[model samples]
Every structure is written in C-alpha cells, then in structure tokens.
Target: MNIATRTLLVATAALTGLAGTALPAASSTTGAPTTASNSCPVKAWGYRGHYMCGTKLKAGYIDWNRDGRTDEVFVIAPNRHIWHTWKNAGGWKEMPGRGRADDMVGDNGTGSRSRCIIVYVIKKGYRYYQNCHYNGRWHNWTTSG
Candidate 1:
C-alpha cells in the first residue's frame, strides 16, 4: 500500500462506491487539479469548505440545476468524501451528505435534459446510500448497505 496505490484506492472509492450501485461515473476533463477556488463566484462553494480537497487530488463539476450551465462543484478531499454545492434564489446552497461521493448523475427529467442533482454516498468500504434535493427539500441519505 504505497502512496500511489493509496491515492488510486482513495480516488476509486471517491468515484465509485465499494458495493452495489449502478451509475456510470462522470468523466472529468479538468486534467490538472486546481489548488483553490480563489475565484469561484458561487458563495458557499469555492476554493474551500468542508468538502474542499486538502491533499489527495480528485475533483469534478456539474450543472446541478440544468439551465445548461454548470452551477455545482465537487471536490474529493483527502478524507475521501465528497464536498458539494449548488445555487438557488436565496444564494449558494450545499448539498447535504456524508461519505465519499461514489457516483453522481443528473436527473434528466425523463430524458429531456432537465437536470437535477443526485449523489451516491459510500462509507467504510461497505455502507452505501444516496440522496437528492428536489421539490424544495433535503432528502436524508439513508443507508442501504
């Protein structure tokens, strides 16, 4: 278990959960990792937060609200979990969840490309769960491991 191996394992755990789940991992083309948001306009999300990566090295972005624009950013912190965010009328809002973000996909409104945010959570290499915010409420990420 050298550093590279650990990094790969941790990155894999962050991308796909260690158990039963079926969502194709999104592709990230942001080749080099950015150190900090230093300039992300979104308030609650950028540069630093609970989910901000301290070291390891993994990240992604998505358009949580569809609007044909990217409004959410996720970072896989050294702790191996997903820190996330999105926007609303009030301001920026954090998508509430714990554990590494295994996989994330947009709810394409039955294939119309109307996007919504959904996150799959993985913990301890076995526990698995998912959550999403829709119709104005935070659904608890219940464990089904």
Candidate 2:
C-alpha cells in the first residue's frame, strides 16, 4: 500500500480498537474514574477526612485500610446493599459485596498503616451486629443480642 493509505489504515485500526473498548469516564473533582454507576446513591457526598453513617440512613466514607483517614466512600446501591468506591493509582474502583453497613468505628489494630474496619451490619429486620475486618479480611459476625 502507498504511505498515505497505510497511515490511514493504521489510524482507522487504532480508532476501531478504542471504540471497542470501554474507557472509564473521569471526574472533574478528583480526576478519578467514575466507575460507580447511577445506581449508587451517594455521589454528591465529598469525604471530609472522616464521616459516620448514622441516624438519617445516609451515606458516608469508610477507612477500610484503617489509616485513620478517609479511604473509600460508601453508598447504598440500588440492590439495597452497601458498596464502597475508592480511588488509587488505577483510578476509582467499586468494592463488591452484599448487605448494608449500619455503622463502623476504629481500626481494631488489624493493619499496618491503617486501622482495621469494625463494621456493624444490618441483616434482616433492622438488626445489626458487629464484625471486624482484620488482617485483610472479615471475621465472622458478632451479632448484637
């Protein structure tokens, strides 16, 4: 092929490849990937160092790594479960899981640089139980009796 035709074909192929792959849209505020869908109910909230999800049945942030700093923002998904979205070097990512996070406090000494996550979960009938995320994973439920 001629130089001009070859260049055009290469450009077309590049464009086609991009079109076939879905790119994560970026946010103007944090420049992170806007991977959380519209189904997430807490996009308007901006994490202000620390926030507690409380009485109003609202949304807040969780220090999943327990660095005593805001790490991920929690939102109630359309499925009625809580999901966390956080940004790293790779941009924003949604933490996958089930159930509502009713409350959380302290790191419980489960991590190196951060506090462990001590979360209270709501399981059927407005009941909540405490659980700890230690050593990079969640321990079994400690039901509130």
Candidate 3:
C-alpha cells in the first residue's frame, strides 16, 4: 500500500480504539453498580471531599484519618443503613453495626490535632446511638439503652 493510504489506515484504527473505550461505573452505597434506573429514593449528593451517587438520604463528612483534611464520607443509603467511604479508597462499605438508623450526624474531635471522627445515629423517637473512629480504629455502635 502507498505511504499515504497506510498512514490513513493506522490513524483510523487508533481512532476506532479510542472511541470504544469504556468508563468505570459509579457505585451505590452498597458497593453495587448504579445506573440511571436504580430505585434509590433520594438524589445523589456531593460531599465536601467526595461525591456519592446513589439513594443517599443524608450524608456527612469528617476527617476520619486525622490527616487535617476532610476525607471521609458517610451516607444513609436505602433501608436507613449507614455506609461510609473515603477519598483515597472511593468505595462504599457498610458501617460496623447492622442497625438501621433514621438520621446521622458527624463532627470532628476536640483539641488541636485530635483528628478523630464522632458519628451519631438517631433512631426511634428519642434514642441515639454513637460511634467513633479514634486512634486509627473504629469503635462499634454504642447506645445508652
């Protein structure tokens, strides 16, 4: 084949390969693949450090790693289950307990450089459960019942 024809064929093949590339799918709170037809009740939300696309009822962020940057993202997925992911991993994982909660709140720990995360889960009408990530570990769900 002539030089011009050969060069044109090579360029066409490269363009075709580029056009066929697939993108990674966004994940739901359960780590399941999410598309446009999922049954998530609420719309996706943008957390401070990361974006969560699922049936996210509520979401909050904290510096769970104590790295001075807000990197941890927590969300209330379907069935009132709490799921969390960080900026580094970008994958959602269920919280330690299997308990379902109605609402969730997060806050940073006290003191300079404390870098701890305190999460509160509200259930029932007047009951609240607490959990925390401190000193590089997560504490299980706790309630004063």
Candidate 4:
C-alpha cells in the first residue's frame, strides 16, 4: 500500500485499540476526598503522586523547594479553586485564600527548576496574583495587575 494508505490504517488501528478506554471523570466539587487513593485515577503524569484526579485545568509542576527537582503540582479543581500536592505526600491541599483561578503559570524564576514561582489570574475579577518559595520559606500571596 502507499504511504498515505498505510498511515491511515495505522491511525485507524491505534484509535480502535483505544475505543475500550474511558477516562476517569473529574472529581466532584464537594465532599471529594483530599487524599490520594486508587480511586483517584487521572492517567496523566501530573497525577503521579497526588489526589487531584479530575482537575479542570492543565497541571503545573515546579521544584517548590529549590532542591533541583520538580515535586510540586498545582491544578484548578472542578470547583474553580486552586489546589496542590507534592510527590509521595499526604494529599492535595487547597491553596491559601481559596481563590478561584482561570489560568495558572509556574516557573523556576532565574534559577534552576529548584526555585518555584506561580502566578494565576482570578476567575472572577481577572486580577493577577503570585507567590514564590525563596529563602527557605514561601512568600505570602500578593495581588498584581
């Protein structure tokens, strides 16, 4: 067969193989367990160690402790509040202030992946806020434009 035909067949076969798969539903907005468990089944890399199963937005990961390793994750929950957890930790915890976010960004600042900084836009007011971990502690969250 021609290259185009062969590619089509391969794609079809791959899709067929995935037909029986079903992605887990997003976690409920209320009464959802805060700890990770087998029922918290998000098949994504960010879900590797935490309890955030049905996050509403893409997950963000950072070193968070300046240890040159990415171990923290931030995700927007189904209720719009931002929640986070660490690798091999206890469970997911809501961010301070319980602010809702429309989008989030995380980076290591000017240093390596060790330095963690996160900025998120509020879902209601569209204002920006940020927090960072430095000097052996996490700075308070502050608002900005």
The sequence of per-residue lDDT tens digits that candidate 2 reaches over residues 1-145 is: 6899957754553333212223245455533333532322234234211122232223245555557776555443322233344555232333333333434432344445433333443433434434444466644444453
The whole-model lDDT of each prediction reads 0.42, 0.39, 0.46, 0.48
Residues 1-145, model 4: lDDT tens digits = 7899957754553333212222234344322233433234332333432333443334376554557776666765433445566665455555654444445665546354335445454333455666566666555566655
Candidate 1 lDDT over 29-119, as tens digits, reads 2221223332222223233343333332222466554566656555443233444555532322334544345444323332233333444
RMSD (CA, Å), each prediction = 10.2, 16.3, 18.7, 13.1
Whose lDDT is higher: candidate 2's or candidate 3's? Answer: 3
| Full ranking by lDDT | 4, 3, 1, 2
Best-matching candidate per lDDT: 4
Error of 1 at 103 (Å): 6.1
Q: List residue ranges in candidate 4 displaced over 4 A.
A: 1-59, 64-69, 108-116, 122-126, 135-137
Q: All candidates' TM-scores?
A: 0.40, 0.37, 0.49, 0.48
Q: Write down the worst ten-residue block by lDDT for model 1.
A: 23-32
The TM-score measured for candidate 3 stands at 0.49
Off by over 4 Å in 2: 1-41, 44-59, 63-69, 89-97, 100-125, 140-142
Q: Pick the winner on TM-score between candidates 1 and 4.
A: 4
Best TM-score goes to which candidate? 3
lDDT of 4: 0.48
